[model samples]
Target: MASGTSVSPNANRTRSGNTLLVWSLLVVAANLRPALTGVGPLLDRVQAELALTPAVAGLLTTLPLVAFAVVSPVVPRLAARWGPERLLGGALVVLAVGVAVRWVPAAIALFGGTVLIGAGIAVGNVLLPSLIKRDFPTRVGLLTSAYAAVMGGVAAVASGVAVPISRAVPGGWHTALGCWIVLALTAIVLWLPQLRTPRPRSEAVHTRRLPWGSALAWAVTAFMGLQSLGFYVVVTWLPQVFRDSGVTAGDAGWLLFLFQAVAVATGLVMPTMLRRARDQRAVAMLSSAVSLVGYLGLVAAPGWALLWSVVLGLGGGACLVLALAFLSLRAEDAIAAGALSAMAQSIGYLVAAAGPVAFGLLHTVSSGWQAPIMLMCVAAAGQVVVATVAGRGTVRPTRP
Candidate 1:
């Protein structure tokens, strides 16, 4: 994260100002969550065609998430070798390919393709904050807010259009998911310019302050993982959970939609507020506490789940934004930010990947929602400790 001691001659391609880069990043950001949320609404169509059972159907939804978790740990290593820009571009290609493969008629191929696609997304997901961290160092909070809003807005669009997109095609799920691949390609096209940026000197690239073996780095990564655990869990399984609690699928999806939609609004608001605080501990605690309220409400009063869904969504949404922002907040340089992002996202996502499956298994074993609901609370409580330590506001690797 130290300033560029220098740029490797081959590394610099098209040097551009931060303004243009931020704008470009925003465009990419808009594409982030759609590939994920878009396919969910069409899961039923997907299952029908494949003749997957209820459990396998659950795996279809859970597969990418599992892939996401599994792929995160390898991101930093990939970024280190390829450079963040190249890595980001490559990840988009992976996403496009993954989405494309979902349309293949074979079952093993479908699952394999899902893993490929999920892995691609996991790579891209970790890289974004690093891009923001490296490029918009001064505007971490504001830029983070923008990125968060883009994620939220796109998720809503994906959810809203999922059914419509599927209905438009006979092979609804295949085409609907395939549609996401196109978006991923577009993001790659926009990102092509970054890949052309000149690489910095060895000293800049290897500097420890921004990336590896740092306290802030670990904190940010852990926070990201914890928060994401809640968010993806809801995204993947919320509809089923609601239905089990007596809500119809339509009502349940709408509840999930509203939660994500409103979370987008809250996502924009949180970074500004969080930045103003000396440390992020209070913000993290509040975010987790609000999520707790939602979890409790949904469990105790199915009648009230609709209202509390708003609260839960808001907290989970903010958690995603905050976790990403930590890359920028903690890293002194973009490269460093990228490294930290890779680490946090990669590790954090793996942690998150367990939520849906574990929750499902818990439901099976305990014969009720109590265990899973309690698990969510415990996850939030753990955040309090991690966030407090992470939010201390001092930079690690101060030598840089």
Candidate 2:
């Protein structure tokens, strides 16, 4: 009776601790995309208010990707030295500050805060997989889907509400964008307990280098980059695309909302699909093909925008879940997962950083959306090709 009492208390404590960690992680995931995604619905207003050209306005989206590309490679080492919990906590501070600074009445503040926001998100992006691999090795697929769905759901909400929020609030778009800081602050509070936990010995003792020489690693990196490019391009430009096609700004925002809402649904279902599949290749190819067809449809008939958004959402959501799942699934352990994630995201985001700028430039130069939509079609085709290699059952070697 005494032993049972002792064990039960300890077990209860463990269970409660784990529950807190899971909620904290989900809150962190919720913060990753809202500040950035909120910008998409308000891009036209920002452009008109600032008297900016489309190409320069594209930079508003590209800047964060650049920051992600630049900062991601160093996160594993930072997490190793500071502990992932401490580093993640610090990142939330940066994200909160960035969101606040972005609300300041200066153009420089807008761009500069975006960089900080990107840097903050980059750390969370690279470390979450490692944390999951370390803490939930048996539940990687389910947890990945869970967080990915949270990301999509919150992102969709941010897009859908930005225009409405801006109108309702005093500061217009800036306030709409800045309101996400509340979430960042909430996440900080939820994550504080993690800072008190001690780092695991393995994480403290060794740091892993990225697997730059492995073909499989490269394949994963390409897959990550291409999928990100597609997602970011849609997030950055879809509202504008709809507006140009005669949709009202309000309706366009709702359309972007619809796109991400579908993505959230797809992300939630991905784990079941992944569980039944032999490997991820077929799923990857089929999703990519669906996205291609959607992009082609957008090019062929802008009137069918709603249909294409749903199609693109299905493909984008599946691809995102797979890309994140591959980070842990292909790695041998947590350390390897951290390294591979850093490698894939650093290079991957760099590739994605070019997408919005290029798309906008094409739109500006050609005076048509077809050319840019076609460019996305090419990217989707590339995703199909890369998915074949990245989706293999082969594990990424621990070291190059």
TM-score of each: 0.86, 0.95
Q: Can you list the residue pairs that collide in candidate 2?
A: none
Regions of candidate 1 where Cα sits further than 4 Å from its true position: 1-19, 44-58, 61-74, 199-216, 395-400
| Model 1 per-residue lDDT tens digits across residues 1-400 | 3453212232332455555566667767776677677655555566677786544655655677677667766665566556767877777887778778877767776787778777777776777776655544567788888888987888877776676666678775667666777667778787887777655444445433334566666777778878887876777667767777787656666777888898888887886687578877788778877888888777778677678778987888777777777776776555556556666776777777777667767877887777887788788878767887666553444334
Candidate 2, superposed: residue stretches over 4 Å from native: 1-13, 199-204, 398-400
In model 2, state the lDDT of residue 294: 88
lDDT of each: 0.70, 0.89
Residue 241 of model 1 has an lDDT of 74
Consecutive 10-residue window with the lowest summed lDDT within model 2: 1-10
Model 2 C-alpha lDDT per residue in residues 237-294, reported as the tens digit of each score: 9999999999999999999999999999998999999899888999999988988998
RMSD per model, one decimal: 3.6, 4.6
